[model samples]
Target: MQLGIDQDQADANSRITAIRAAVLLTRSMELWRRERLDPETVLINLAVIAITSERLMRGGLDPKHNSLDVYLPLEKLQGCNVASIAAATGLNRETVRRRVKSLTSAGSLIRTASGDLALPPDKVQERSAQELVRRQLEALVRFANESLRDGVLMLSDEKG
Candidate 1:
């Protein structure tokens, strides 16, 4: 039986991409679960999106406002943990706390604690560029740690 082109493509390209994607997705979920990311964390991600979009717009390009960005900074900043959420979203502390709480109760956010909130996994996945940037940061941190370790080893070798 001859399957459709999608089936054929799935059978072929899927082998490579699917496993990688699944593994990456699992890792992301694990991070989210273990870290219990707050609304501020999600807001930080939105801020990055906003900054990127602003840069794009300034570079002679048309950039659309991310819905999350618009909501967090403009509307949803009131229900968060004030200082922390404000620091994350660049909004006023009182505003962030209020808005974050409302969003959390409405299921627009994943509320881990009175002081913490995060965008749902679906929303986070929808904004996968943020995740990619985070992965890049993780890689950089790992590289830096390795370099520091190697430097220490070299120093010890020289001493001994």
Candidate 2:
């Protein structure tokens, strides 16, 4: 006896498998970065604040229409409090407080008027952040183009 599979169904399954692998690879990179930043995890947590604060400020704005100049105003951005960060990251409140204090001292994070934590506007434009973003974008583009060429992903008819 032999099992039979249709070509269309097999193609769809291959695409799904490829996407799942890509997702795992992306998450592994994030975990690796977190581990490489510090064994204590303080730097990684601080980095999360620096990255997420920008996204939170951007809110429902289209990327093309959003300007860093408009969103980089530290005062205009909402800060993430220790409790919220703790809840989001699954870290204890004390750990969050301690790490946040260290980050503040290191100039990576600042204390807001409401005693919440935020990334400094200057920090947002730091060379390290810029380089990291550049490298990540390149990696993503390479992955996407390779996937398209391999027929594991499809692009719609829309062009930007």
Candidate 3:
């Protein structure tokens, strides 16, 4: 059986998805800045990692299965160089370098032999990752429960 959605429902879903993406991105930036104490540095670091991750994923690397070795390969992931990151983020090369240096010193980033930066899983703090994941899951669950309570979705056992 195929599930179908009306045009209006599809449009609403698209709008909701866009809004959620915007909110999530803003909140993620805020959280990173609060944790790092520097918005520029946090943003640059995030950009570097994000660019690197996307490049690797596009190259057929499955992050969920390959671990850090795949994402932060020693051979350098294409399009993840400091220059590309600086260009994509519209940040000065020097500023990107400075933030990359800081992140490297903090052990949250690693530089490959070719000078590409990446966020290896080993460099990440497990507790911090766990906490962030927990917070995100809680937020999603709370949102779903609130929607259910407000009659946006009916419980499985509820009579129509």
Candidate 4:
């Protein structure tokens, strides 16, 4: 097998990325399990967070509110619905609905008048959540460094 770095090695990149992603997901599940969070619930929460992040990247958000200490205002978020979450995550709609209901009741997630769901500011501000983000980020950084060293991607040589 060709182990040396190849810049055009799309297959190698896919395999490496999948491995790194699984490690992150497993570590996250372990942390969530210790917190008594169901894996499915955690997965659903991740989908919601991912959707919110996409909006942030698109700009027009007031950054002050979208911090670890606070979440974007419901009105300022496109948010996510159970059906949408299920669609995006490829999870069963009923499963997403059940978890969303439970999370809302437990105050882990907030529900808006538009039937959209979001992670609450209080949840984001939790010490455990902060710790989780830190550890996960560290793992991601390692993955990035490894990928770069393996030539999975690179900084543009050309000036933009």
Give the number of colliding residue pairs in candidate 3.
Answer: 0
Residue pairs with backbone atoms closer than 3 Å in model 4 (clashes)? none
Most accurate candidate by lDDT = 4
**Which consecutive 10 residues in model 4 have the weakest lDDT in total?**
1-10
Backbone clash pairs in model 4 (N, Cα, C under 3 Å; residues 3+ apart or in different chains), count:
0
All-Cα superposition RMSD per candidate:
17.6, 7.7, 6.4, 4.6
Sort the predicted structures by TM-score, highest score first. Answer: 4, 2, 3, 1
Q: Which tens-of-lDDT digit does each residue in 45-119 have in candidate 4?
A: 888988866777787557676567775466766768888899888999998888888888988888877877888
Clashing pairs in 3: none
Better of 2 and 4 by TM-score: 4
Tell me the tens digit of each residue's lDDT in model 3 across 25-95: 66666666656557777667667667866756676865464642223444545546668778878989898
TM-score of 4: 0.78
Clash pairs of candidate 2? none
How close is every model to the real structure, measured as TM-score?
A: 0.29, 0.61, 0.59, 0.78
RMSD versus native structure for model 3: 6.4
